[model samples]
Target: MLRELLADTIMQSAQLAERPEITTPPPGVSAHFSTAVAMRLAKQEKKSPMEVAAAIASKVQENAPFGLFLAVEVAAPGFINLTLTPDAHRGVLAEIREGGERYPAIPRKGGRTIVEFLSANVAKPLHVGHLRNAVLGDSLSRILEASGEEVVRWNYLGDWGTQFGKLIVAWRRWGQEEELQKNPIAHLVALYVRFHKEAEKDSSLEEEARSEFRKLEEGDAENRHLWERFRAMTIRGIDAFLVRLEIPPFDEDKGEAFFEGDITPLIAELQERGFAKESEGALIVPLDAYNLPPGMIRKSDGGSLYLTRDIANLRYRLDKYSPQRILYVIGNEQSLAMEQLFAIAAMLKLDSAQLRHVKYGLVLGESGKKFSTREGNTVAAEEILDEAQRRAVNIVNE
Candidate 1:
């Protein structure tokens, strides 16, 4: 309101001086008003900038129509500064008190946005690395919604992949029903860590894991049932952690497996459009024209990779939600992969939806190294929250 008043006063003074081209000063807190319009007018009128400023200031003070300013003065060469009356400040505060929560509202014309974050794989527990992703993504979604944007908080879980294959193998070998009943997520992480250790000792374990995963993918009843149980347990664990942290529930919890059937058709369409080509035994999209490395969609083993699943998932999202933009809150390490994905999407002529990768720096331990679950050098998200709660309790008692 103060800004509007100042602008109107400046504009009126300019019109009265017959200098309609003179621009009004923008409202600022550092000074009530300041503009170089006087200097520009002086240049055209063949007079000193200070002289023009004085003439404008005198005219504005004489009118003083609103009487909302303590003083309006010409400073230095051609600057105009206005000090608001004390009543103006009091009035602004009273208005804010009356308005309460709806004091300020900004409207956005853009359509709905999908914010994807905290996409942790079900093979492990939520770690310190995921904390940053969750906090940043959730905060951004809240801010966008507050600014009048329609937001979809998406949790794109990494429930499908080779890691799941290894996890299945480990769980079948070492998983005990009693331990799982006690703590599902912890038991699963232990199994996952053990698998890596055992696979290191017996290289053939890697092939076995792959085979088991393939069985799951091929609709083997036992493997499918086990996978479903693990998925459910992991989701339950995630929900508990979110509740502990006071984070809101996700709008969508779709995983990569949800789009498994879409991969074939998506790849076929890419190939039909001349975007995909056979490179060696794998299917790849050549990005030489874009000065980027080729993006591999399928491996020599005829297995689809992350790129393939991502493309299919993007297609599904565009078709289902028809969002104006898709924001992926991920680490900086995946910047190249994201670039390649967007490039392939563009080549496929899927340019209607905007794709954004909101990359953040890695969260490192005190040793200046990245936190890794596989390396067993990471802090669990639950532990961090527990420690914070403990400290708060101590403070309350004090």
Candidate 2:
């Protein structure tokens, strides 16, 4: 409030075309507030910055209302610094007191924000890497919601593509009903890992998996049913993890599959609009103008790529939510892919919404190695739960 008052005072005294920028003076500056309005106006008036600053300081000292400043002084170059009177500081406290219990709330800006995070592929355990994404995204959603924005916490599960096809093949070959019922995600993870291991031994398994995915895309009833079962089981497991960790549930769990139908139409539009061209039998959006590599939208096999789905997702978000901001709380390793996504969006000339890739770093194990499935090591789960419970108890007692 005081800074705003100071800004208003500067705006009036200097007769500024716009309100001047005001800020808290850094320590050792010996002032409560500071502005550089005079420096910005110097070229307009054909006067040196220091001369302009002195003139504004004199006028502010003479006309500032409410006894706001104990002293108004001109500092180096063109900074006009004000040392506030005690009464001015007391007035700020009175304003805060009037705000009462609702002080944390902000004025509404009339737009929603969607934070998509912890988007771990289904059929995998929630690991340390996913933990960072969840915590950061959940915290950010809370902060934005408190700031009076309607926030949608989304978990865009990675439920589509060749991986599921391979899993379906693995299920038919080796899956047991008992094992699946025991722990769905863990069993799916094992079956998927088994598929990769067998694929190493038999080269034909790769083609078989791809064929299964094609059938799935064509809506084979058996393949679609299996995929739905996988998704349902995985969501239940993921929700249990979130409950134990106290992370909130997502408003939407629609995965890459949600935008699958839109991709074909989108690709056609891109080609029609001259934004896409065929390269090596794959559809790509050339990004030479953006100083980036070509962004592949469809693979040579006619499978829609993640980039294509992400572009469709952006369009869907605009149509469905019209959010002011869309934050992708992803990992740092995918920075380049995120760059490509944004560039491709620009190529398509999609409606504008702030698309931010809020990247986070890896979670190092106790031995300092990044956690990997192939490495066969996991942090002590009981230890983490114990520590969390202890802290929770302490909070309750206090």
Candidate 3:
């Protein structure tokens, strides 16, 4: 936030810092700096950059803002360049000392924020692929908290999904209860990987998986028992891993799937509010205003999606905490979906609740490609962590 404010302020202050004559003809060339301000102005003013630079230089004199510059120069095509005196730099230093952290910084205003992150599936071990969300979400939550916003850090685990059924099948087929006693996550991951391998040749495995999921969803004793055990094991592993990385434990809300049982009324409310509509037997909220791809609320199979569950979750949050804002520290890949969600929320007249999506770019491999960690993998989070630690150790020792 401060970064954004400073950029704006710097541009504004630069204009005022220059003499009127220097800035009038060029429009944007400032007498206080030397970084293409005149060239940019020339482009905007439809003149040669040199002409802009000359016009700006003509007005520069001793009596500039902060008493920083006495003259300006026109360089190359149309660049107004400035040579600042020692007093200017010293004054800046003084300003820095006086302002402290708020040196051109946006003051933290009180508000409530909900941060959802690290939503990996429960059936599989949280792999290297899931590290970005965990780290990024956790970091953003910390930053928000530090900035004086009341933050509710949510993990939103992908625990309630179809993959769990496959895990259940694997556990019944070839799982060892004794090994799970030693290390639950490793034991479950082994079974999960084995299940995937076996399911390839045996097509009947898919049906078996679905049956297991149905039983679990219907609250069958055995399937529920297995899922509980798996969820506990995975969460425990995640906690330990986060500790090892020195990252604080993320708050958990378990995401949309966890709230599905309680979202029917939410869907009804959406219909009442005219936010959701039935399209080809599935529920959808049209997102033309958002300029995004169509977002599905519910699938034809009677299963809900993130959008529907999010509406329910938002309503729940609104009712419970009455938060001022919802911050999603998500990856850039889901930008369109997030925009659509925000648009729908707005259409439902949730103007009081500010919805923000902080998206980060993809972390690419050194070769500028998407990273993978399989046999032919280019990148792995664990390996990156290990190497980082190694470098730190070397630096400390040196």
> Estimated TM-score per prediction?
0.77, 0.71, 0.66
Ranking by TM-score: 1, 2, 3
lDDT for each residue of candidate 1 in 1-398, tens digit (9 for 90 to 100): 44555666776855645333323455553454455667778888899988988887777777666656678777777876667677877887888788664454557657789999999788578988888889999888877877778888899999888887888889889999999999988888888888898888999989998999899889999989888998999888889878876778999999999989988888898889888899889999999988899999989899998889988888878888899899999999999899999998888766778999999998889899987666667788888888988999999999
| C-alpha local distance difference test of each model | 0.82, 0.84, 0.69
**Model 3 alpha-carbon drift over 4 Å, by segment:** 1-109, 364-380
Which one wins by lDDT: 1 or 2? 2
Clashing pairs in 3: 22-56, 49-78, 50-77, 50-78
- Cα displacement (angstroms), candidate 3, residue 62, comes to 28
Please give the distance, in angstroms, between residue 377's alpha carbon in candidate 2 and its true position after superposition.
5.4
| Consecutive 10-residue window with the lowest summed lDDT within model 2 | 374-383
Could you give the candidate ranking by lDDT, starting with the highest? Answer: 2, 1, 3
Candidate 3 shows a clash count of 4
Q: After superposition, how far is residue 321 of candidate 1 from its true place, in Å?
A: 2.0
Candidate 1: segments with Cα more than 4 A from true spot? 1-103, 107-110, 391-398
Candidate 3 similarity to native, TM-score: 0.66
Compose the digit string of candidate 2's lDDT tens values, residues 251-303: 99989999999999999999999989999999888888878898899899788
